[model samples]
Target: MIPFPESTLLVPRTLFGRGKITALPALGREFGPRGLLVYGASFRRSVAYGRLHDAARGLVEWAEWEHPGGEPTLDQADALRAAAQTARAGWIAAIGGGSVLDLGKTAAGLFHETAPTAAFHAGQTPRHAGIPFLAAPTTAGTGAEATPNAVLTDSNTALKKSIRDDRFMARAVILDGGLLSGSPAHVIAHAGMDAFTQALEAFISVKSNATSDALALTALGLIAAALPPVFAHADAPEADALMAGSHLAGIALAQARLGVIHGLAHPLGAFYHLPHGLVCALCLPAAIALNRTAMGDKYMRLSETVGGDFATVTNTLLATLQIQNPFKGQPLLRKNEILDQTLSSGSTMANPKRITPADVEFLLSRLFV
Candidate 1:
């Protein structure tokens, strides 16, 4: 068994409350007067953005960059880095969904690096500590705020992968339920599933330890109980729990890593342009079935935590949220490429059951129908 995690990556300071987003400007002051604020259209339409902007009116010189819709890409990170450099920004704060946060985090982490963004994505080590990165998540998923790695797609190569550096960790995180209020029901559902999968995968990971197990289990319970309500009503009081659950799941996964679902999700989502969470949600049942025997007693622990058999509960939850399998009946494009990437993933290596090419083929067979 993997030993307990003695050292872990973490966000140093975190503020949590319903209205904590209003405090962003004050927090930005700690870094300096100039900063970059990265966000998506959904955030821009919300009242929270106004609150953030009004609060920063005289205090922070924020260069705002709005992310055009779609998965985050290397070019987006490069553009953000250029914007930050041009503004001579002392800090970078992202307030949006996972894509926005990943882009912001990547740009901030590479702010001082002279190498192209692709080089870092290709595993080049970053030698500089980036400007401070502060995160306020608008959606209750991804946990990007709590992790030091940024997963971005390279449009040139059509590859999706993470670039990690200890210095890439967020300097501060604001978990405000108010931000979640603006998320669409579908966004809430997809993101919630992503969080649930992360928590579950981390809990059962071969690399899991004492600290990660504790956190991941708690995260699982919280997300399991709160996701449905939050999905049904964005302003539900359960939003707070969902947000916190997602954050804790992110923190846990940072230490324990994940499993084959994530391994498959990255490659499949990249190839099909599917949302990350949707891919995770679709992959859950098959993953649970694949790993059930290998999970040992931990599988029972998960079932108890989520109330009843975990696999049955997951299918019920997916149906409750109207999550359908999109991969069924689609032609399996880039089969070899997808197989190679999934088999090579770091997350795949961390699976409770060692994933083989046959295991991946089985998963693909289930998805492609």
Candidate 2:
């Protein structure tokens, strides 16, 4: 097996544990004294936010930008870029879910770019290096902290996609279970499923290498064991394991890429204004069935890792988390558009099974009914 990806990018430094967040200010100081802090509403109101600010007090100069709501958007990114510029920030640190991190990551990555955010989202290469980006994920999913890509939506076109540059990778990451304590049960459930899906997809990705496979399998095991308890109780003792699993899943996916579930999640979530993790949860079983044949022995390996047949484990978890099919009775919107995007996605192309139009149609059909 290939030892590693022909090319690999990873977060250069990571700090993990209960109060690791307090280190953010010190970490950002490595970049410069001035920085921008991006976060979501819930985080802004939480006590951890106060603790973060207390730590930042004399160590760094931080300008705050609250992610207003909804998915990360090109417009929002541009606004954040402007905010960082106005603050003369030397780095950007985001502490929240995937959307908040994506916004901050995009802003920092594009801080020196001359063109519109849309240009990069449309596939233009970044012409300049961005300020240092640091991440602390509040959710146990997305692993935005470990990736070199930021998924954003272009509201004008309703296209949700990633703007990736090797330089977009975080300079440092803080994985603290303290950040996960305040997330609602639904958020925990959805994010846990998303993390599991990411780990599984990375394990089965055609681009997966020996190193990525090992990391993905470890992540799968950790998430499978920790997710259910964490979903039932956000502050469960296993939350730390869940957070570690999510981070590992992010790293694995960054190296190995993902499958159609992620490929489809982007467009479907954007079009329907659904939560991204929810979309991944709803699409995963179908993807498993689609890729099972090609997965061969690895499929059984995954089953064993998760402590049951993969399909049965996933369905059981979904039910335990009270995840219902939201698309069951809804009309399929933008079918042609969704199909086109799914076929062309970087994630879809990495599927263990080569995905066809018929396969995408089949997956959609399963969801709608």
Question: lDDT for every model?
Answer: 0.92, 0.92
Error of 2 at 360 (Å): 0.8
Per-model TM-score on C-alpha atoms: 0.98, 0.98
**Candidate 2, superposed: residue stretches over 4 Å from native:** none
lDDT of 1: 0.92
User: Candidate 2 — what's its lDDT?
Assistant: 0.92
State in Å the error of residue 51, model 1: 1.1
94-127 in candidate 2: lDDT tens per residue? 9999999999999999999878899998889998
lDDT of 1 by residue, 23-44 (tens): 9999999999989999999889
Supply candidate 2's per-residue lDDT for 297: 93
